[model samples]
Every structure is written in C-alpha cells, then in structure tokens.
Target chain A: MVIKMNPYIEYGKKAFAKNLVYRSDYIIGVFNTVIMVFIQVAIWRAIYGSNTQINGVPFSYVATSFVLSICFAAALTANDFVLADKVLYGSITTELLKPISINLCIMADTIGNNLFKLIMQFAPAVIISGLFLGLLPPASVLMLLLCVFSLIFGFLIVYYISYIIQACSFWFTNVWSLSVIKNSVISILSGTLIPLWFLPDWLAAAIKWTPFDVIYFAPIQIYLGQMNTQEIIFTFAKQIVWVLLFAVLGMFIYKKGIKKLCIAGG
Target chain B: MRKLFEPFSFYFQHSKMLTKTRMQYKLDAFLCCIAVFVRESAGIVGVFLVLQTFNNIGGWNMQELFFLFSIIFLTYSFLVFLFSGIRDFSNIVNNGEFDKYLLRPRSVLLQIISANSDYFAAIGHGTLGLVLFIISANSIGTDWSFANILYLIITIIGGVLIQASIWLLFSCSSFFLIKTDSLKDFLYWNTRKFAGYPLSVFPGFIQKLLMFVIPFAFVNYFPAQYFLHKPDLAN
Candidate 1:
C-alpha cells in the first residue's frame, strides 16, 4: 500500500528533528520554565497564607492554574521574530518565491516547534509541579478530557495571534515594541500572572470579553472544574470563535501585505 | 586624573554614536520606548490587582508594596540601560568581541557597557519608576528632608551596584562554562521574580537566601522595611 503525506506535515517534522540537535538550548529553556513555575507557586503560596480559599477559589486550584500557565506559555512559537527578521533582511523575497503560502509555512513551523516544546519542556514541568509544588489534580476525568480539547483550541488561537503580529513586520522595520505591548497585554488579560478572579469585578469582566482569556485562563478553569457544564461548553464555543476570527484576520493581513510587496516590484 | 576621565569620555562618545544611529529610526525607537513602558508596567499592574483584591500581602500594605516595587524598578532599569552589554557577555566572548575590546585604549568594561547603552529603553523604565515612586512616596507620607533625600539616593546607588555586581559575576562564569545561558537565565529570572514581592512572603530559607546569599533583598526589601519602620522585624 502507498501512503500520501502533506508537505506541510513534512516541514513540521523537519522542524521537530532540527530542534532535537540543540539539546542544550532546549534543556536550558526547560530549566528557565521550571524556575518560573516555582516562583509563581511560591508567590501564590505566600498570598494564600493561612487561608485555604480566597474568593471561593482554593489555593491548590490556583497552584494548578500556574502550572498550566507555565506549560502553555512554553508552548509558544518564535514565528514573530523569525518572520520579522526575514522581512527586515529582504530574505522574505526568497520565501515568497516558493510554491507554498508563506503564512502556511509559518503556521506549520510554529505548530511543529510548539509540539516539540510541549513534549520536551511541558512534560518535565508537570512532573516537577506534582512532586514539589502540591499541584491539584483535575476536578474529574471528564474535566481532564475537556481540558485537553480546550488546550488544543487555545493553541490555535495563540498561533493566529502570533501570525497577525508577525504580519505587522511588513510595515515596521522593528516590531519589538508592538510585540512587547502585545505580550504585556496578554500576560495581564490572559490571567497568566494572576487569575482573573483576583482582579476587580469590572476589570475581570472587561478581560473576559477579550480573546486573551481563552488562551490560558479558560483551559485552566476547565481543568479545575471552576465552571459548570454549561459554562464549559460556552467556553469552548468562545475559543473556537476566537480561533476562526483570528485566522481570517491573519490571512487578510497577509494578502494585503503581499499585494504591497507586488506593487513595490519585489 | 587623565586616566580617571578616560573611561567617562569613551562612554560619552560611544553613547553619542549609539544615539545617532538609533535616531535614524525615530518612529521605531519611539514605539520601543512605549513598548518598554507597557511591558515593565505589567508587574506593577499585577501587584495592584493583587493588593486591590486583598489589603496586604505578608503584612505589607499597598503603599509600602508600591514603594518597594518602584525602587527596584528604578535601580534595575538604570543598571540594565547602562550595562545592558553585560547581559550578552557570553555572546561577546564567543564572537571574539572581547579580544577587540582588550586592544582598545579604554577599559573593556567601559567599552562593553557604552557599546550597548540602551538610552531610549532606559527612559521608558525610569519614567515609569519615577511616576510610581512619587505616587508611593505621597501615599506613605515620606518626608523629603536633605538627609532623607541623600539616603534615598545612596540606597538607589547601592541597589544599582549590587545588581551590576551580580551580572558581572554571571559574566565571569562565561569564562568557565561553555553554556552559561542557563545560569544567566536562572539568576536573571530569580532576582526579578523575588524583587517583585516582599521578602517576608517566602519561606525562611528562601528569605535568607535572598538576604544573605544573593543579597537581592537589599534591592528593595531591606530598604522598604527600614523606611516603613520595621527595623525590629526580621522575616
């Protein structure tokens, strides 16, 4: 029997294989992530001093949220900087000459890199959290299943967001500032630094209206069973919507940027 | 006397060159300034949200916390802006930049630092810290007498020196370790993380580690405690 494979899948596999050669780099990356997780846990532990629950959320749950946050944060791509460099150096012209869509190539590469990191960094982080940090178990078996699905959707949303940011490099010689602003807003609004529950009611509500929460907070909420079944379904619906919306937005920007490139005779 | 001023003049010249090059991209530099402000302000925002949720953490109120945070921010950013080159010392060693620096008439340390002076980035962080410092001082009713002002300046200088010393130590490690990025990352992340909170929050051992082992506690924790009139208390 013969089998057919997608070339994008091949590109992803190549990326994964290429990363394996840099064992020391990824090991350092993992260690950095572990320290981050530990610091976050320690901070939360200090905050919960002598109180089992604050605002109806348990300390154990918060600890678990932080562990998951570190995991997802590690599962991020270098696409924005890579794309920016390619454009800045005029290497993007060569990339454009390829038969495949540059955006699709970016998406595949990001997915490949993130998948490798998720396995290499995230797995060790989870074990470390369980042994040292007193991480809470999922609320239920069903919740664990739902959490995985939510995380996959969350990854898609995050990927599209990165793509959109990378597209901005066409206009700016340096997207460092824009990237920094995006990161700051995401860290706050995504509940990675502190859970939305700890935020003021008005501010928390405002953040909930944005897609940032779906990337990190929603998956953790699902894992902790903080929401009812109805709320869980609603969360999944929102994440899917965000992923679709951002995917369209990213493609639109890429098309316009490419059109500009043609007009410039590049 | 000529030797003493040599480093200063070299730094001034290099910084001037860097400023001219950076000014070529005015809009990008301006955007980066805004970016630095927003990125650094995230920690303050997190502290604010935490304090707003609960009146205090580890017996320190919001105003005291702000005071602690602002001082660390001011000194850390100042150090980073002036000696940002130290952060990439490993790369310099690998790329033979250090060899070139050694051949120059000026001290290598001055050249390295002046080569990487990120003035615009510093402006963003320093401005935010200054704003936070004023607000915090007002809330805490700090008396700005000559002695108090002198003391604050001394403390800030001390903090900057301590931070620079830590980075220098890390840079030295690059001479021995083939891969120093992990060590560098650990030091950088831990100090930034620990400085953002009151030292009292951590377990006793970690507190001691920060206070004596790393002495990062001096960055903000010790100064804030002294000013807040908690000299008798030890976490």
Candidate 2:
C-alpha cells in the first residue's frame, strides 16, 4: 500500500525535482487545457467587452478556471512512464529486485519534476495571465477546501492513468503511439484543447463519465464552486473508482508484462 | 564542376544505401508516415481550434499563419533534408562514432550532413510545405507585390540559417559535453512547441526573451509578423 502523506507534499516534491535534472529540457506540450483559457480569454474578451457573466461564469471565474486547470495539469504531469522505460531498457529488472516498489520509485522520480515544471511552465504564464487578465476570488473559503480535495483526487487519477498506459508497454513495443493517443484524448475530452464549459452540451455530458475530465476539469469546476455538493461527491467517487480500476488493472498487466520482459543480455 | 557535384553524389549514394536497408523492412516507411501524420495533424488540430476562437491573430488570420508556416516549413524541409547528418552528431559524438567520419576522404560537416539526407525525409518536409502553401493561399488571399514577396523570401532564408546554427551549436556542445544529447531534446521540443503559435500570444517579456535570448522568433514569428503586416510584441 502506498503510504499516505500530504499529497500536496507528495506531488509538490515530484514537480520540483523533475525541473532540476531536465531543467535544460523545457519543451512544449499538448496545450492540454490552459491554452484554451488564453485563446478563449482573448476571443471572449473581444466578445464580452468587460461583461459580468457568460454561461454563468463571470470573467474573473473564467480566468481563474483556466489558470487552475493549467497549473493542476502541470503539477500532475509525470515523466510519462519512467517505470515502463526501466522495464523496456532492462533497468526495471534490476530495480524491481530492489526493496522499493517500481511504482513508488517512479512516483518518487517525478516528485521534484512536478515542482520544477510548475515554475517553468506555470509561473511566468500565471503572472502574465493575472496581469493582463485578472481571475476571480472564490465565492467562499469552503469552496477552496473542496477544490483542494477534488484536485488531490484528480491528481491521483491522473498519475494512475499514466501508470496504466505506461504499464501496458510491457505488452507492446511501440507505446509512443499510445502515449500520443493518451494526450490527444486528454486534449479533446479533458478540456485541454478547449474548456469543458465551452464544449457542446452533449459532448460535455458524455465526457463527464470518462477519467479524462477527472484529471483537470473536475477539480477546476469543483474549486470554482461550479459544481454543487451532490455533483462534487459524485465526481470524487468517480475519480476514486477510476483510480482503483486503473491500479488493479495496472498490476494484472504488469504480471504478464514482466514475463514478457526479455533483458537482452540476461 | 567535379568539386561541386561530389557532395551531391555523396548524399545520393549514402541515401541509396540507407533506403536499401530501410526498404528491406517494407512496413517501416508506412509506419513512419503514420507517425508523422499524427504529429502534424495534432498541430493542425490546435491551429483549427485557434481559428475557431479568433478570426484574426493581430489582424492576420489563418492564411497568414499558414503563410508563416509555409516559410518555416519550406526552409526547415530543405535544411533537414540536407543537414540531417547533423541530427546524429550528438549520438555519434557520445558513442565515438565520429572516428569513422574522420577517417573518410571529405569534409566532416559536409559528409555528416549529407550522409543521411534521403528522399523520404525530403518528402516529409515537402508534404508540410505543400499543405501550408495551399492553406496560406486559401486563407490570406495571396495578395502581394513582387518586392514584398522577394523580401519575405530573403528573410525566410536567413531564418533557416539561424535555426540551423542553433542546432549546430547544440550538436557541437557534444564535442565538449557528451551528455549534451539531453540538450538536443530540449532544443527540439521548445522550438517546435513555441514556434507553432504566434509569439504575441505570449506576454511581452516572453516575446523579448525568446526573440532575443533564444532567437527562435526569427524562425517563424518575426518573419510571419513581417509578411502578414502585424505589430511586433516588442513594440
């Protein structure tokens, strides 16, 4: 069982350390969710021209939603399967026989990375977004706490989802394509490319059931008080369900995948 | 004439050899094509999303973005096709693969650059440039004076050289730092990602930093703004 720590520390450490080693490797990625915040902010600002509300989201709330989603996504971003890499490259075999679990070990690797990425990816952008486009202060203190809970569950679901995808690489030679598909799905379904708020009503309803929305959108909505008590509870429950589902699924696949792992020289 | 044609023959010869080995696996080419398509299409998807968001990016629309993309694509295509040998520099330097290049009879950079330049690689750039050209003409309405078009062409050529030099600088670092291969990933990622969007969308500081500090702006955004008659972020 993974030891329970403050996930804020757990994830914050992951983000920080990743930035240290690959500090030089600051690369661009699938605009996931925040790109829309900027794009829409520009497009909508041109549309609303200092309006109080659109689709029940005040301009301030809308701005906050975008920043929240982007920072959350970055904070949760991992090295994308360092564990599978260890397995494919024969490094996992040696590490597996070590006392630590590969899953925890890989998670540990991303601790500082998550923090680093936030600084690199989120910091400057936040400052810029705030200066040009201000965000909403939440309606109450209670909402902030709820947002925190939703975000933690959202992160657990995010990392677990990556683990599931990476774990499958044991069975497949080319997980790159699958990794691309994973992010692409996140881009469209998770509200990375566009805000879930702006998605067609039917598409938004359909995506709510999938794990992708739970990654970033769910937390942002929950935090913004856009979700009611019942909806938040349901969303949290769905996130846990996906986490349990993916974790169980990951272990089963790893069992078969380990047998398939051919350490070339060994 | 002999000196001029020697490099051409060298590229053709090695590429022929490379193709023979590559074609031996008939599906490799097809698979590579699919990967390229997915990667490019993802960018196109984002571009589509942006077009949906705004009719104008600083008074320039989708076609203007394509016009900019075309210049970058065409120049990058020619560079990657001819200078692809440099792609292996970091790897080669790390693995001590340079000894073989040194033992050969021609210039090191020239041989290395052309050693891997092949037709399929050329075609990858060809497809992107063609697509961007079509879209640029379609979106921008293609009204330009002869002088304006010529200046745009000149700037693009200069832009390609700047990008090529940066790639070379990253590769050369391997000569001193074998682990510089890690930096290659950084360079490729940042440039590809940042170059895709209009620099103005980023804040003023970023516009200045990337343009001046890294100078990646020259590759696409600066020239795009110039051609499309848009304002500079610095201004």
Candidate 3:
C-alpha cells in the first residue's frame, strides 16, 4: 500500500522536525513560560495584597487568566517571517511556480511549528504553572470544549493577521517593523500583557470593536465563565468574523502584493 | 595603555561604518526605531493601566514605578548599543564567524564586542527612557542634588555592566552547547521583565532570587528606592 502525504502537510512536518533538532530550545522554552507565568502572578499578587478581588474579579480568576493567556501565547507562535523571507530572497517566485498553494503551505508550516510548540512548550508550561499557580477549573466541561473551539479560532485570527502583515513585504523592503508594531498592538489590545478588565472603561469599550481581543481574551473569558451563554456565543461569533475578515483581507493584499512584486535576479 | 586603547579605536571605526550602512535604508531604520519604541511602550502602558486601576502596587506609586522602569530602559539602551555583539555571540559561533576572529591579531573579545551594534534599539530605547526619566523625575520630587545626580549616573553604568556580564556569561555557554538562545531568554530576558516592577511586590523567594541569583534588583528596584524611600526597601 502506498500512502502519499499532502505536500502542505509535508512542509509542515518538515518545519516541525526542524524545531525538534534544537533540544535545548524546547527545555528553555518551558522554563521561559514558567518564569513569565511566575512574574505575572507575582505582580498580580502584589496588586492584590490583602484583597481577595479587585473590581469584582477574584485573585484566582486573574491567576487563571495569566496561566491560560501565557500558555496560549506560547503555543500561538506563528512564523511571521515565513512569507517575508521568501519574498525578500526572491524564492517566492519559485514558490509561486509550484502547483501547491503558497498560502496553504505557509499555513501548514505555521501549523506544524505551532503544533510542536503546543505539545512541547504549551503543555508542559501550562501543567507546571497550573500546578504551581493553581488554575481555576473551567466553568464547565461545555465551557472547556467551547474554549478549545474558540482557541482554534483565535490561532487562525493570529495567523491571518500575521499573513496580512507579511503580505506587505512585497511593497516594503522588509516587514520586520510592521510585524513588531503588529505584535505590540496585539499584545496590548489582546489582553496578553494585561487583562482588559484593568483598562479604563472607555479604553476597554474601544478595544471591544477591534479583532485583538478575540485572539486571547475571548477564549479566556469563555473558560473562566465570565461570560454568560449569550455572551459566549457572541464572542465566538466575533472570533469567526475577525478570522474571516482577516483571511479575506490577507488574500486581497497578497493578490495586490503579487502584482507589485518584482524580483531583480534569480 | 596604548595597547588597551587600540580595540576602542577599532570599535569606533567598525560601528561608524555599520551606522552608515544602516542609515542608507532611512525609512526602514526610522520604522525600526518606531517599532522598538512602540514595543517597549506597550509594557509601560500595561504598568500604567494597572496602576491607574489599583492606585499603587506594594507601596510603589505610579511615579516611582515609572522611575524604576526608566532605569531599566535607559541602562538597556546602552547595553544593547554596546553589547549586542555579545548578545548575538551564539549566532556568530554557529555561523563559523568566530573562527575568523580567532585568526585575527586584536583581542578576540574586543573583535567580538566591536563587530556590531544595534543603533535602532539604542535610539528607540534611549528616547523612551529619556522621556520617562524627564516625566518621572519631575513628578517624583527627587531632590536633584549633585550627589543624587552622581548616584543616578553611577547606578546606570553599573546596571549596564551587570546586564552585559549576564549576556556574556550566557553567550559563553555556546562553546559547550549547540544553542543557548533559549537559556538566555529564560535567564536574561525573562528576569529583566520581572525587574521592570518593584522587587518588593514579589514573594519572599522571588525577591531573594532576583536579588541573589539574578541581581536584577540592583538594576532598578534598589536604586529607585534610594530616591523614593519606599517602605519595602528594608526588606
């Protein structure tokens, strides 16, 4: 019997295998996550000194939020430079010539890297931090399932956003700055650095309109049971909408960028 | 003394050429500066937002917190500008560039340290640090006496050395290990993030760890206390 793997999957597998070669990186990645989790928890503990909750949110809730947010952030490591590097080195022309979809190949490669991170980095970090920091149980098994579903959507949202940014490489000399700015914006608005609950009411309200929150905060809310059933459904809808919006925008820019792309040499 | 000064002269020439090359891409250089500025400011914003909601953390007010962070940013600017070569030493080693340096006449450390500099990070972090310093220095009511100014300058220099030494130590591991980037991230980057806030807020063990194991507390927390005189300084 002959079983042929999809080319996209093969690319993804290659990326996954590439990451595994760096053994020390995986070990240190887990420690990095643990330290980050500890720092966040420590800072929160400082803020919550002698008080059980602030603004109606419990200390445990904040702790749980950090654990989930940090782990998800670690696992959501989509290679923002995958396409940018190809475009820069003029290899993208050869990529285009291949019968396989370049977009799928990028996505598959990112998924492969992310899958490795999820297993190697995210799982261990979450377990260690969850044990050390004491994560709150999910609101329900149903909520847990929904959180997982929402997280997949969040990953897609992040991937598409990075894709949109990298697509600008065709016009720009490099997308490094664009990617950095995108990361800063996402980190702040997505509740990865600090939960939106701590933000001023006006700022929090404004952030609600952006796609950033759907990336991390929405899923945390789903798991924490901070949202009611109506709100959960609404948040899921927002995540899906943002994913679709970004995917379409990314494709549109990619098409425009392909037209603008001019390789000087082989 | 002349022999000692030779590497310094060489470093200046190397960095000068590197700067000129980088300046040719004016827009990219400008955007890189803005990118680092914005990226760093996000953490400051997080701290600001948190302080706004809570009013204070572990006896440190917003102004004191900003002062602490300013120290970190300022010292880090200098550290990255001068020691980026050390920070990226493992890459040089992996790329087999270190072997070329070993064959050179000048000191290997000097050649490595003078090889590259990140002017963009220096500009970006320097600007943000200076902005934060001016704002916090004015509002924090620190008596800017001559001695206090001297202490600030000395502490910043000390902070940069302490941080650079840490980088050097981690990069040295590359000789024995295949990769040390993750270890550097775990030890240096992650520890530095913790140093952005007051060390007093952490648990007793974390405070001890930061003080003894990492010594990051001296980078900002303790020096800021010299001016702010926070209650937790005794601990």
Q: lDDT ranking from best to worst?
A: 3, 1, 2
Q: Write the per-residue lDDT of candidate 1 for residues B81-200, one digit (tens) a residue.
A: 888888778788876667888897867787788888777778888988898898889778677788888988999999999888888888878877755776666666556765768877
DockQ of each: 0.71, 0.16, 0.80
Model 2 chain B: weakest 10-residue lDDT segment is: B185-194
Quality of model 3 by C-alpha lDDT: 0.88
Off by over 4 Å in 1: A1-5, A76-78, A262-266, B1-4, B231-235
lDDT of 3 by residue, A225-249 (tens): 8889899888889888989999999
Q: Give the clashing pairs for model 1.
A: none
lDDT of 3 by residue, B1-235 (tens): 9987877789999989888898998999999999999999989999888877887877788888889999999999999899999999899888788899999888889888888889999999999999899889988988999999999999999999999988888888899885777777777788877688988778788888889888999889888888887768573
Off-target runs (Cα >4 Å) in candidate 3 are: A1-5, B1-8, B233-235
What overall lDDT goes with each candidate model?
Answer: 0.80, 0.66, 0.88
What order do you get sorting by DockQ, best first? 3, 1, 2
Q: Which ten residues in a row have the lowest lDDT in candidate 1 chain A?
A: A257-266
